[model samples]
Target chain A: MTRTVPTSPPMRRSTVADQIRELILSRGLRPGDALPTESVLCETLGVSRSSVREAVRTLATLDIVEVRHGHGTFVGQMSLDPMVQALVFRGVLSPGDNLRALREVVEVRMALDLAVAEKVVAAAAGETHPELRALVDEMLTHADHGETFLDADRHFHTMLLESIDNQLAGQLVGAFWDIHTAVLPRLGLALPEDLRQTSKAHGDMLAAAEGGDVAAYREAVIKHYEPLQRALDHAN
Target chain B: MTRTVPTSPPMRRSTVADQIRELILSRGLRPGDALPTESVLCETLGVSRSSVREAVRTLATLDIVEVRHGHGTFVGQMSLDPMVQALVFRGVLSPGDNLRALREVVEVRMALDLAVAEKVVAAAAGETHPELRALVDEMLTHADHGETFLDADRHFHTMLLESIDNQLAGQLVGAFWDIHTAVLPRLGLALPEDLRQTSKAHGDMLAAAEGGDVAAYREAVIKHYEPLQRALDHAN
Candidate 1:
């Protein structure tokens, strides 16, 4: 099949950044892979050293590249920090009575939990996550003491996320979790009188994991977040 | 109920950044809200001016604040540029034969698309999006001419996302889409032989939207992505 080729445009000063990004990607550079020195980049791209430095700095600010002191520039680790911060900022800035934003957050979290649950169950091969079981136990113990088990509750979900063994999944889940925690205070959410129900929901999930039932696990995960969903509905 | 409050520790330099963040949140600062001058912040927090500047600079780097050349610093708009860049970088850097990471990306995209479809269908109230109809028409026309309709394909999904009207949702879908596109070339994905199938799937989605049948809409979406999923499976 013949396709038309578009005419090429002249490279302007601003094209330097695009060129550099293409260079890095085309070279298949990974995190910690060093880029050519500024002088070399300048000579190769036929751009000034200052322009190359500026472009590199801009990339660094976006977490695309890292400049180590006393060392050369290298590809940077993928980070969810900025995304997490953006979510928190947007959540807080959402207009009054705009519960849709909150709902979207909850919806995304539930989806992620559902996906991660299936992964955790699959990874277990009909076994259960021992760390998740321990966390659930800690949650029950704290609830029995009439104390909030937020930390243990967080750990339970985090443990399941870890079993997925995907950095992207972990980062996205963690970022959304931060948004949920940040908004919880403003929602004035109180612990349900029957914290035991919360425990029971988690127990169901653990059982489903043990049975390798993905559908049941998803249902249990949804049940676990029902209280928060209810609170959000009431707020709306 | 009695709870013990921990005593405050002596002021640490590193705490200055946290204190500034707290100040911003406590004040309910929004994007474009100007922050206090460096001198004022230093005095209010009982920290040195340099420390105040350093904190502000760090925030600026994270795109949390914008320092105008002439005017003082202000809160920055919520941005997903960094997150998009991070996703693209991570997708490229993923180790060889890492089908799990690709699966996670596909899972998240499917979940998001499902949620957005429900929202779009509900919002339509039995009416279909005319813009989507136009895009689909363009897609079929292009497909008939032996051209790839990737742009129209993207617009159709993006239009659905816009109808949801949640910035967080749009940002995430765009980020995950970036990862999907970045990995597509590596997968050596080719167009499916049955262009008519692709056109029919979209037509079904449009029909579901008109009928306000969310389940049907979601099914159509899954059908739309089937080609890519098959390609990934083959690669694995």
Candidate 2:
């Protein structure tokens, strides 16, 4: 004997997801808080078990909801992981000779970093950032070995944004950085040949920040990304 | 008689999603390119049919894949819709006395706008944006009636970003604006009472752009967001 199942349309799944989101909000559920079980949600939403399961699966991708096997569902951390994934996929999907997606990511990253230069300088006023200095030193060491310091470079940018006191900005910096790093390799694009120039740019940024020269810091930020921009242009 | 079904673990679902993404990348599928059918995907990935369905649902949420009813799944538009949804949900989940999520959105928007201000001014040099002026006029007309011009305000910012020639920045401006507009009403936050002041800030922005004065334009952008900032602070 064969059993037949009803197919839930995509629109219905989306509506069910929205309803679950509304349920979470109405109940004032925080991240990590347990949500109603699958059967419970099915009954509450007046939808099929398959619909609830599909909706939960969808929300989980956005980090809006978390599902733990055997344990049940809960609120999610709501991180920007989904954005990074989508961005990286976009970069990967761009046809050869069409690096617009990656270029757009770089432009936004530069814009945000340049825009926050003054704020970062102000936040670092009369304060020493040993952590940032350490990252720069690590980059320089890697440069001396004629190798790229991807980890140090990522950490340096993340640490720089920390001074701005904007969590969203910090997360964006991280997200864009992840996209750039993930996409560049897949495109067969090499890092700038002049690792020293890149390393020195980080040093210049630190010096300008410590000296509280916003103009110099902004210039350094531009100088830092210039090499990567050239590589992208060359690829295009 | 009762039928038994096996439950797929969350990790398995995630792995299947990754494999599907890999398949798309390997096949060089562009947005709207249809994927193999569910049975084909299950056979190819060697995963259970239910696992493939759940994985597709997850990928659909991130917009990495699109599933059309009665049609095959295809590569998605890969737009920033998922980001906007995640951000709006974040803002909505913030309880009273905590407007941090919304404030962070505003700060990022302001930073991005300010960062691109000089570019916008340069791009507008020797050129007039009739569309932008029309938006400002629409905003002013709304102000005269003691009402808010949300659509005009949104379009104005969007048109301003277009001058910078950065697609990602434009999308982000739109995304954050959506979040702000969607979240503020839910929080029971009211727009600033001085509609005239808010409307005039747009005028100043336009005037500054037309004159190619970056400083003035930056100031106008800051002024435009100040009232909203004040509202958020008051809410906090």
Candidate 3:
């Protein structure tokens, strides 16, 4: 059975998708809102079920709606991964060249990084997750490896994000990593002094994590990002 | 060929995708770096070609890898639109009121919006694009219908992005619109008063477009968003 098929003409699926998305977005439709059943949709939109189905499928990919087996379709609250993936991909096309845009990106990254750090501290205070400690070991292993260390470094941050347990925030931050890579090499190797400071600061961050000191944890993260930004500026 | 695949060990596609992505990200492989052919990748990772293809496809979607029609895949440069889409989708999935996250989203939106406006000032200077003017007309249609002017509002900004001819930036900004729908009712009525103010501001923006006065254009956009932000706060 179809839901409210939009009364639009050919290419009805796109039209239906657009209208339904428009309503859900404008009216703030939530889960369980009965989308016009197939018949109602057909009557309303004056379209075929196939068109409705296609529209519904597109929405499904966006996680805008869920099609149940036998039961009626429901609204979907999907993960941000797909959308995040698209943004990062597009950002890749431009390569972040505008000095103003780059600066803005960095500034925003700082806020997100700080927020993640704050969360990490809160999580640490509540419990000692061995997984977090294990990252330190991995970091050490990467420190020994020449080229492979970057992955280790990324892993440390990715792990830190996981500890925060905000997947949406994590995904947003992940996009930064991609853009960062596009421009990072121009920034040059971390100054030994900067790396030293980073390591020491990381130690402090670990402590904050252990102690569950939200403020300190957040500060530590900001501290880490600051040098990276400086290094990036130097490269650019 | 799959590089990160572990055939005998049954390595997961995600594992391979992650490793390859990191490699590209770390500048181990630069943009235009010819990614290893599939067979080589399979041999290196001891995995099947199918696994390699899957991994590459994921990276392609992320814009981390691009496969030519006949040529092999190469590392993708930064792309913003897809990443933003993915991020926004993830944000929608996150639990909580999302009001705070919306603030961050708005922050990014403001940056992108202003950037596009600024770019339009550059690109549309003395250039004639009836389409943008047409968007203004479309806004009127929406206003006449007593329908929400959000789509037209979005189209206007999108027109600006397109004016600057930045597809990725446009996509990032579009994703923001999609996510911001959650806060719409609280955002503002887009009532006659708001629409008039918006339409007037848009007219001024067109003047800025003709004059290439970026600062003036940005100010005009600020005028539009400020009330919307306040409405959001009031609604929440």
- Worst-scoring 10-residue span by lDDT in model 1 chain A: A3-12
Best by TM-score: 2
| Tens-digit per-residue lDDT, A108-154, candidate 1 | 88777765766767875566567778878877787787776666666
Q: Model 1, A25: alpha-carbon shift in Å?
A: 4.0
Q: Residue by residue across A1-236, what tens digits does model 3's lDDT show?
A: 11121111112125776565555555556665656677776677777887777666555544567777578777775544444444333333334454434444555565566646656677667566566566566555544443233454555566667765555566556545544543343333343235544555666677788897878877787786676667657645
lDDT of 2 by residue, B76-148 (tens): 9877777777777888788553888888888999988887787888888667878888888988999999998
List residue ranges in candidate 3 displaced over 4 A: A1-178, A181-183, A186-236, B1-15, B18-45, B53-57, B60-98, B115-119, B126-128, B149-152, B163-170, B182-196, B230-234
The candidate with the higher lDDT, 2 or 3, is 2
For candidate 3, what is the DockQ?
0.10
Candidate 2 Cα lDDT to native? 0.82
Q: Could you give the TM-score of chain B for each candidate, in order?
A: 0.73, 0.87, 0.63
Which of candidates 1 and 2 is the stronger one according to lDDT?
2
The root-mean-square deviation over C-alpha atoms between each candidate and the true structure, in angstroms, is 6.4, 7.9, 10.9
Question: How are the candidates ranked when ordered by DockQ, highest leading?
Answer: 2, 1, 3
Q: Per-residue lDDT tens digits of candidate 1, residues B1-236?
A: 12221112111134776687768778888788998888889999999997787666555655667788689989877666556655655665563645666666877887677767767777665665778788888878977877767667666666667776565676677657666765565545555555656776887888888898888998998997786677677766
Best by DockQ: 2
What DockQ does each prediction reach against the true complex?
0.26, 0.30, 0.10
What is the full ranking by TM-score, best candidate first? 2, 1, 3
The sequence of per-residue lDDT tens digits that candidate 2 reaches over residues A1-236 is 12121111113256888899889999999999999988899899999998887778778888888888889999997877778788788887884637888888999998888877888888876778888888888889999999988878887887777778677888888778888888888788888877888899998998898889999999998999988998988887
Candidates sorted by lDDT, descending order?
2, 1, 3
